[model samples]
Target: MTPPEPLRDVIARHGLQASKALGQNFILDRQLLARIAAIPGEIAGDTIYEVGPGPGGLTRALLDRGARVVAVERDPRFLPALAELGAEYPGMLEVIHADAMRIDEPALAGRGARVVSNLPYNVGTALLLRWLTADWPPWWQSLTLMFQKEVADRIVAPPGGGKFGRLSVLAQWRSHPSVAMQLSRSAFVPPPKVASSVVHIVPGNAPKDVAARSIEQVTEAAFGQRRKMLRSSLKSVPAALAALEPLGIDPQRRAETLAVADFVALARELG
Candidate 1:
């Protein structure tokens, strides 16, 4: 069998360049891609869901690891290259050309599929929130996603830190999230301005009887005015404010000072 073309050669052959508008930054290093594919752990036979697979760089790594990948790509320009990759991998790769934001991921990827992606920067946070807030015991078995270093810090930040806020609370309240690896800006074909980090998250015990929306509402109210005391910030959410005193939480505390459990408590109280 003929050896597959190198990623750089593929890009050159396809006249492909990362699109700034699409938040595309291609990672061509096979070793780095392999490391990323390994973040979710032991996926030899597991199905993997990927997004924005520009030039199929990471897709190749996942396929090489014996993973069956369902890759979503919105840009038509890269479809031909991806089609070639799909052919190379034969039955292992399924390339879907659609906007990932509009597609029904759970239905397409099915239950217990692992989500691993070098997410597009423009929609990274919004996509993370979507997955985090999906129906309890989310469809995906795990999430190994790449994000700007700043956003990664927010996801794993602890209470009392400036980075800790709604994202931190939501991520931690029901899951274990940690920075799996850090990548320098130079790792990309056209380097992004900021560094990047990969975050691996698996579901943890979520508080029973507390609705995810309630947590979202409470955090929205609190962090919307993070500089103000909880008593002042949560005033917009009367139930949240009233619950604070009853729950023995200091009304004088600022949002950033509260822990994930505190937010869950507030959400439970709001119920």
Candidate 2:
């Protein structure tokens, strides 16, 4: 097989630089990118969806792992570099020049694919939330995504920690989320201001009786007033308030103290 051209050479050849406005921080380290690629293990035939594939660093890694990649990139500047990579591995890469947030992800990559990306910092959390709220046993088989460490902590945070809140509840309710790897700030080309980590999420069976929307409502109200007791914070959502009594949960408890299952039970009662 032909070797893919050097990524740095491709970038320089295309006169490309990471765009700060787009939250772009290109990961120039091939070994580190390979590690990110390995998170979706044994994915040879899987259609991997990658967002913001700046200069195709991780993209090449994914292709090297034998994944057929659908990479959605907003930055047109990196297209030529990506195209060069595509040529190296014929029919292995599909580069979409569009904003990931605006695209129909499931329609683009189809169902049961793994989503793996070094996501743009600005849209990372929002994108994760979007995927999380998708239909039970969501379209994607798994999410192996990079985010700022703080956000990664929030996603995998357990109850009682300061990082545990709405994101924690939602993420844990219908998925198994864990930190796959931590990356230093120096890993990127221009380097992001903060350290980053990869969070691997595999969808689990969602509570059949509860609406995902209801869970969002419950957590939003509960965490929106996190300092207040559940009785006070939940007053805004009568369903959640009503749930506490039936579930034998103390109304005086704060949001941070509730388990993910507790939130799911409350959401079940909300319907």
Candidate 3:
């Protein structure tokens, strides 16, 4: 059988261009996409939930790696191309025409599906927050997502760094997150102004007896006024402020100085 047309050829034939409004920047390099797909480890016959699969580039890579992909794409312009890909992959690819933000991922992808995507820049952080705050032992098995380098840094940042804030605490408190790979700005068709990185995250043991909301509440309050001392910043969350003393966290410390474990401890004390 003849080899399938290259992704660049498919994009050219279809006159498809990345839509700026949708935060689309198409990556035609199959090698890079394959590397990204590999970051989630072995996935033969596993279900992958992909968001913003513009022109089906990453979707194709995941399918090639023997994953069954359910792709959520909001841009109607790329659906035809994605449909063509679905035909090639038969039952392996399922395309959903809907905004990923509104999709109930657990209901759609079912429990324990791996979520892999080159997420749209505009909504990536919001989606990550949603996933991070989902019920304990979230529906997804793992998250392998591409984000702008700054956001990726925030996801994996450690305490005492400028990048360490609410995102760092939330991501680290319940999961192991790492920068799986970095991609240059020039890698995309319409290269983004900033470099990008893929973050690999697998769920870890959440602190027992601590509600996820309590952690979110504490982080939001603490980081909301990050420049201030914890006693001042956490004033809005009286419970968190009250718990700080009993937990032996210095009231004068800034939010960035506190570790993820400190935040979890505060949340546990909030209960």
Candidate 4:
């Protein structure tokens, strides 16, 4: 068997560098890439959808672990390098040169695939929210994603903390999420300004009869004015105030004080 080409050689050969405009900070550390890859455990034979696989660092790790990868990369500079990886891995890798935000991941991924990416900083939160609120159970089996530590904190944060707000409510309501690993700034070729963490998320049963969009609206209204009482903050959302009384929630309470279950109940009543 021929040895696989080293990532450094591949990047040097292709003259690839991270693009600040695209929020790209390529992870060159092989051990760190391996660690991120291991978060979605038991992925053998599973299809993995990777976003922004610049120079194929983590993409290589995913393929080495007996998984087929569909990697979406927008940077043209890295395409040849990734194409080389595709050739090395043969049918195990498919490289798509397109923006991740516009693509229909579910349709592209089919069913039973897992989403694993070292997401670009600019679109990390938007992409996560898209996946979370997607039709349940989400088409993807699980999400192993990288994000700024602050954003990751919000996703896995429990109720009552300052970090617990709209995102905290929405993510916990529909999925089980935890910070799987923390990567320091030094891990990347051009370190990001903020620290990063990997979040491992698995789909969970949404509240019975409650729609995800309703939860999004309820949380948006409730946290839009985080400092105000629910009565004041939620006034813009019709029936939100009216639903509070029947659910036995205190209108005097602020958004931060409400539990995940409280938000679910509010969403159900709003619907």
Off by over 4 Å in 3: none
Q: What overall lDDT goes with each candidate model?
A: 0.93, 0.90, 0.93, 0.89
Judged by whole-model lDDT over C-alpha atoms, candidate 2 comes out at 0.90
**TM-score of every model?**
0.98, 0.97, 0.98, 0.97
lDDT, residue 209, candidate 1: 86
lDDT of 1 by residue, 50-150 (tens): 99998998998999899999999999999999998898888999989999999999888989999999999998999999999989899999999999999
Positional deviation of residue 219's Cα in model 4 after best superposition, in angstroms: 0.7
Clashes of 2: 0
- TM-score, candidate 1, is 0.98
Can you tell me which runs of candidate 1 are displaced by over 4 Å?
1-3
What C-alpha lDDT does candidate 3 achieve relative to the native structure? 0.93
Model 2 agreement with the true structure over 156-266: per-residue lDDT tens digits: 999997999999988999899999999899888888889999999998887789898999999999999999999999988997798797898999999999899899889
Off by over 4 Å in 2: 1-3
Angstrom error of the Cα, residue 136, model 2: value is 1.4
* Count of residue pairs whose backbone atoms collide, per candidate: 0, 0, 0, 0
In the range 1-271, model 3's lDDT, one tens digit per residue, is 8766889999898898988888888888888889999999999999999999988889989999999999999988889999999999999999999999998998888999999999999999999999999998999999999999999999999999899999999999989999999999999989999999999999998889989899999999999999999989999988888888888899999999999999998888679
